[model samples]
Target: MVSIIFVDESFRSGRVCWIKDIVVAVTAENMEAMRSIIQRYRHKRISLAEAGATRHRSIFNGLKALAEDQPDVVIIHDAVRPFVEEDILLRVVTAAKEHGAAGAIRPLVSTVISPSADGCLEHSLDRAKHRASEMPQAFLFDVIYKAYQQCSDYDFEFGTECLQLALKYSHTKAKLVEGPPDLWKVTYKRDLLAARSVIKEKISQEICVVMNTKDEESAGHLLKEVLKKELNCVNVTSTVLDHTGGNVQKFPTDQCYSFICVNVVSSEFQETQKFLSTLEESGLPLLYPVVVVLVHCCDLTLAPLASKMESLMWIRSLAEDMKKRNVLLSGLLLNYSKDEQKLQESFQQGASIIAALVKERSSALAGQLLLA
Candidate 1:
């Protein structure tokens, strides 16, 4: 099933304060699975409605189930299209409240042609003059519910478009609003791959760098600056992890999936352990694989390379343990230097590695260590 992220932006306007509920219509065979998945979001009011054989029936049933709630507006969306933005939803709902109905539309990509009875093309439509209807449609609750109540059996069995029902039965012409390119639906095997790639790209765009307050001018801060240059398009944020890990608690709530814990003051993994504990306590990793790159920066002149590596070798076992909880833990050892040029070179190398680990998010390198 496609996972949809619902962001409530309705607080910005008085028309819609919050999403009252989310109704998912699914087949009987998939009802248990859907319920199991929906249970994860205890904070949201989500329920499942029994789906019918036809698409129109499924939608009508969903709307009928919500009639008792007497909501001001109803937003209908396809579960297959998970990339719908919050702004599009808000616009549709606001427009529906004013115009009685509203839906998203995109410019037709190819010319839609009419075929004759003999299966040959009879005529072609002007693609520039027509638009492709998309999901995230909205309507005034009474208008859509009454339309479904009055629709015929033939329409319920064969009809696919809900906007047409509102126009034909309720006399409500739906307002067509333009949508973005990412509103495409997942329909094929290749589309699943594309959706996964898009999701990974979206989650990797933000990185949170956690370090101790004592290392403000240390290699950790330098690496943070270099990372900003390496991943120019990504949002890089740095937070100080105090003894209580108070400041580091906000990253998970901010939906930051990538993290780099810079341990510059100690050879042991005390800072990294504290950071991981905070993340575990939040239970954010249970939803998605959290990319955690533990960076140990030290000046090799003061410590032997063998002893330093042996001290941190325990991270490999810890990484394996964290991976069980959906946390992708990896280690980076950066040889800190006193020379200006040497330090900059080392930080650049570490920055590139961190960027790759965050972007790919491969499980294969979960317990491995990379040296720079």
Candidate 2:
């Protein structure tokens, strides 16, 4: 129910048209960037505001824009730093509520030096004693509003820091929360690429279920029911591969980026293997990072060591090949049970694994074996 106001600004150069295109793609079919997200997700509590010419002016305008709404706290974050996490947001908001002001900080990665008029370094400051102030700074609504109102025009036009404004006007010492390195801002073309990649990982929600089980009807029905309830705004489809594997043609392989291969046992990986081939032939991985999950439902008590080893070898081989093309491959061995109680537990666990794979978006899990 928390509200977010995404501040927008004009880029100085036309070379960065891609940034505008990315924003347009993300906020299409809605009012503004923040409003689009709020409406798409049916979040009634959030709102948006047009940014001002300068950073200080934008924050001041944002606070004034939300004044009538009477938000308990207002968070001012830079749009360039897109890696801000929800936990860090919570920490800042909580601290702001308690201390009137709070901000994220990281250890200075480089030494700070004072330069003389001749542009030579005069002295160096101890890096250990200093910290870099980062975005996602929060303040009690009244505190920031009053600070902005009492500020001088020179400070408003030239100041780059918000913590200093709060300290100068309201005498509020901001609580500093240690933040991770991913909070780094996007300042160059390479940084923009990294930011876009992070955004893709967070926003990708479509998942495909490749059913290779003998009881395709039952397996597909159970997975659909669980996924529909567990994942939010997820587009899930089940593809049933016939004995000849030609039925795979019916799958909308290009529409979905994540795939889950469901099989009754390790040896039945042929169908899943076939689907992986289909993916490679389509060349989707080269355009976007693809995630492939192999879920093997088996009665481990009845499975022999030889079959398990064979499956592991196959998984490893496929994973190695796919990794080269930006396709992440992971496997889960689930103990199948017919009893209603055990079966329910397994279904939940399996659904969780699929959800985690799609959400994490990291290749570290590739070639890893998981027990569900």
Candidate 3:
């Protein structure tokens, strides 16, 4: 699924914004499914149009549905290009309002060569002069709608460029706006992995650490302090995980995807399982992978390493099950020391491990337990 996150940095309450409504155009067979998926993310009503067989036809159908609204400007975006930024959207919309049409452009990576009839390279176009046309294009609604109305069958069948139609029918030249590198579309299997990595990095910026006990002197609190130092760039917050998980519920599910569950007095996986349950009930993992690092601080004088490992071996199985739900659960065993210096060192090491897990968010280390 193509996941999109819309951000308006200049948004203000009670102020008019360029985006009035969002509409998704999909095949008739997938309309209902798309509606359900959109409803999960957006509570407000979003219009859905039945798409046509071809690219231009689908866009034409979407435009036809907006005829009644008669919006001043219409922005066209490819669902696969989920990394589109708000700056590009604003620039295109503003340019389109003035120039009648506008579209994003990127520098071409390779030379465009023309092949001869015998399959040999006949000529090559100057790559420096040409730019790749990209999505997040905008047009005057009336101008594009009229252009589509006059489209021939061949145009709907094979024509992919919307700017060309505007220029051909309305004689409107599109203002080309340069876009960022992240505007590239997800087209291959490797692109899917890249998309996930980008999404993971975006969501990993904030981490909510949950402590099972309310004690200020608990090992969880110390870990939280070290985490703050280690992940200085990250926004980290700590809260006591009560029976109802009220504090955790206070955190907006959309903002944070990484969680550190500190189990000091309780049994291993008890607090982590509770946090995971709250996350599961909220359906946050459905949007992206939720990283939950289960941290257990053990005093070797009290609990032997072999016994602790044996008791916590069940986490491997639980991690496997949670992985299916997009919850990456990992365990960290920290050797507790009475000396302040040694304890601080252990906390620092544990914080480093947590930072790596949260940043990379690799599923390969989900079920493994790391010692600090």
Please identify which of the two predictions, 1 or 3, would achieve the higher TM-score against the true structure: 1
- Indicate the worst ten consecutive residues by lDDT in candidate 1: 1-10
**Could you say which candidate leads in TM-score?**
1
Collision count of model 3: 0
lDDT of 3: 0.78
**Model 3 poorest ten-residue lDDT run:** 1-10
- Candidate 2 regions with alpha-carbon error over 4 angstroms: 1-3, 9-46, 199-209, 212-256, 260-372
Clashing pairs in 3: none
Local error of candidate 1 at residue 86 (angstroms): 1.6
Question: Which lDDT tens digits does candidate 2 get at residues 53-77?
Answer: 5667767766766767667777777
Tell me which of candidates 1 and 2 scores higher on TM-score. Answer: 1
Compared with the true structure, what per-residue lDDT tens digits does model 1 show for residues 1-372?
A: 111112111111112337767777778887777666656533356666788888888887787778777788888887677777788988888889899999999999899999999999999998889999998888888898899999999999888788999999999999999998877878899999998998898888899887766556866688888999999999899877663435656554457899898873344466567768788878777667889988888887888988877777878888998888888998888988887787888899999999989988898899887888
Q: CA shift at 268, candidate 3, in angstroms?
A: 8.3
